[model samples]
Target: MMKAGPSQEEIRRHNLGALLRFVHVRGPASRAILAENLGLNRSTIMALTSDLTAAGLVREELPRTPGRRAGRPSLVVRPESTRVYVLAFDVGVDRLTVARVGLGGVILDRREAARGRVAASGGASGAADPNEMVNALAAAARSLVRKAGDEATCVGAALAFPGIVRRSDDQVMFGPNLDVGGMAIGEVLSRRLGLGVPVAVCNDANLGAIAEHERGAGVGVNDLIYLHGDVGVGGGIITGGRLLGGEDGYGGEIGHMVVNPGGRRCACGSRGCLEAEVGERTLLDLAGRQESPDVPGREAVRAVVDAAARGDVVARDALHRVGTWLGRGVADLVNIFNPGMVIFGGTLRDVYLGAAAQIRSEVATGALAASRERVKLRTAALGDDTTLVGAAEFAFADVLADPVQVLARLRGAPASAPVP
Candidate 1:
């Protein structure tokens, strides 16, 4: 049986999506630039832009400085960032964040709260209880959404979670350091939010990879890896410009990779996992904080890194040891994926800044010359907000995929309300 190709309508719809996505990611573009980048003729680009502009997804304006060499300057198309937006949520081991992000990847507003047993306000049952976490997130989200102007409309929403997730159903299968497993977090939160939109849930690390590739350090690189470190480590890999999500969307659990067979036990009941060797606990213990009262996470990590910078021998040695194991895991990933870049996010960003020397030495010794030669290693360009920005990107995906139809439908729908 022969499969039919796309109809003219389908082709136009796809092109509409592609054109909108280009400008949303790359910012404003002239008609000529859009046509050139999208590989479409000027007329075709004009038609698509017209459709988008009519749908209120984009608006055209004069460029600030039209070069004299140009014959009548072409108008520049810019995303209607203020009017079109999405709600982005980040569920982490130690905190919760909700943001209103616009079409052009600009964060308009946000709310945040501390979570986990380590947080000062974390009484014990923190993110583990889905209901409690959902309540906190919903309250913050409502406050954020209430501030939106009447002209503003949310197109979609998504949650970034730090755990193994089944993206197809928004299910958290496992969380070694977190405890929100086996819960329909998105569905539960969706009802509470009353945005009349389903909240998509995905692995935090994967979103980190997507954000980094699109707007962070990995931008313009087709092959890259993003390692997110918090209470534990999770990874996102981009191979050939696409995420290497496995058959079940759990492909990037890079932290649990066994770097030492008979070493310290891990939270996932495994010994010598990369995260176990280099994660929060390892760094804290090595820095000799045996009975610290505060939670041992990013703040504690920063304290250690700061101490190392001040020439504290204990902190320096601790970072060195962890960086050695981190390098081994990074080397293995380099050998396997040969990514052009490897970015460290979350707490690892601090660790990397503190121990780049040790990690590079280990990678030099462990990774093959060809694989490691051009692979740049660095901290996340988006800083600690890497995963949170990723959530915004995820929320914007569908709208970016079909801007005209999605915006039309979203605007036509009744306004969302808080569930009383």
Candidate 2:
């Protein structure tokens, strides 16, 4: 069997990579800042930075702000021209977004497709094969690679599905929302593209959580949750400064928590689940079905909030309903995980903003005092780019931190090894 923990060399590389990532995300820093940010001494930072500079992974720039005590400011160190890029893909129920992101989380370019069941058709003019969607994604990625114009050394593609993902094998175990099951997306994408670079697959909400933790509102705090209220409900969790994907990578499926006993039925054959009550479809049904003005659920929630903003009773009632269900779900999470922060990401961010106070109020009242004390609820900072950036970071760290995983990708084998 492969080793259980990082090797000596792997530990060194991992620490160095973590140091660089800290600088990349937090911006230019002096030696003091670097040491403070990464908990490394000046000597350690100097040694690792020297190695990084020689490898063209980092550069020093003039400080943007002068110190209060110094005549001349110390040089600020940051990532350099040698950067990696990722083709980040977010596959939702009705849309697919592909973005070209740099190593430092900059979105260099992007493309989006407004696809629904048609995406299932896979551009075949008729059929909706999961492989067909993968093929379309491959084509989109190829176009992006060509457009990146020489800055692309390797393409790290991250696809976020709306269901369970076996990270160990990179297999999309189940995506009932997209009508897919047991598909090895990472393997097929690598074959389709012929690039032999690292490809990753993750639960959409988990990625959202990771994105937020790394670049969005969850920064600087561990024990956080990212609850996604969109077409379907999904969640991502972080604990102890690391993502909390269980042995099967299905640990963060919080939407399936049964909150109501006699509620609506869900795709998972359960009734009264949190997702059944607060999912996009639930809101659409509440707003009335087709021939009654087809308002997208998220849009409907927004309209309800907008009307409420103008003091409309009906809109106010709808928002209250949403807030109540959202609160119950959050209360349960707070009791269970006691996260340090809880972010409202996904389509809900826009709608939730109008009723955020009410939602937090409910959570604060309903959850335990200790749990509530530790949590600070907020909206995601990186918005939709969170997943894409997290995906790129995943690939960058995976490859550099674990030479074995890197060798696996180069040898066209599955990255079954533990992520460093």
lDDT winner = 1
- Native-referenced Cα lDDT, model 1: 0.87
Model 2 residue 246 CA deviation (Å) reads 2.2
lDDT of 2 by residue, 1-420 (tens): 976886778667776777777766776678888888788888988888777765555677777665688477777777652355667777776566777776566777778765544321233223246776777677787788777665344535677777888878877777766765567777777777666565788888888888898788988888899988667789999999888899889988888988888788987889988888777666545544321223434555566567778997766666666667778889889999889998887766765686677778878788999878868878878775666666666666654464334433544553332221
Model 2 spans > 4 angstroms off: 1-11, 39-44, 64-73, 117-127, 289-301, 399-420
Q: lDDT per model, in order? A: 0.87, 0.71
TM-score of 2: 0.84
Clashing pairs in 1: none
lDDT per residue, candidate 1, 83-119, as tens digits? 8888889987777889999899998999988775533
The TM-score, computed over Cα atoms with residue i paired to residue i, of candidate 1 is: 0.95
TM-scores for candidates 1 onward, in order:
0.95, 0.84
Angstrom error at residue 189, model 2: 1.2
Query: Which candidate number would show the highest TM-score if scored against the true structure?
Result: 1
- True-structure RMSD, every candidate: 2.3, 5.3
Residue 65 lDDT in candidate 2: 64
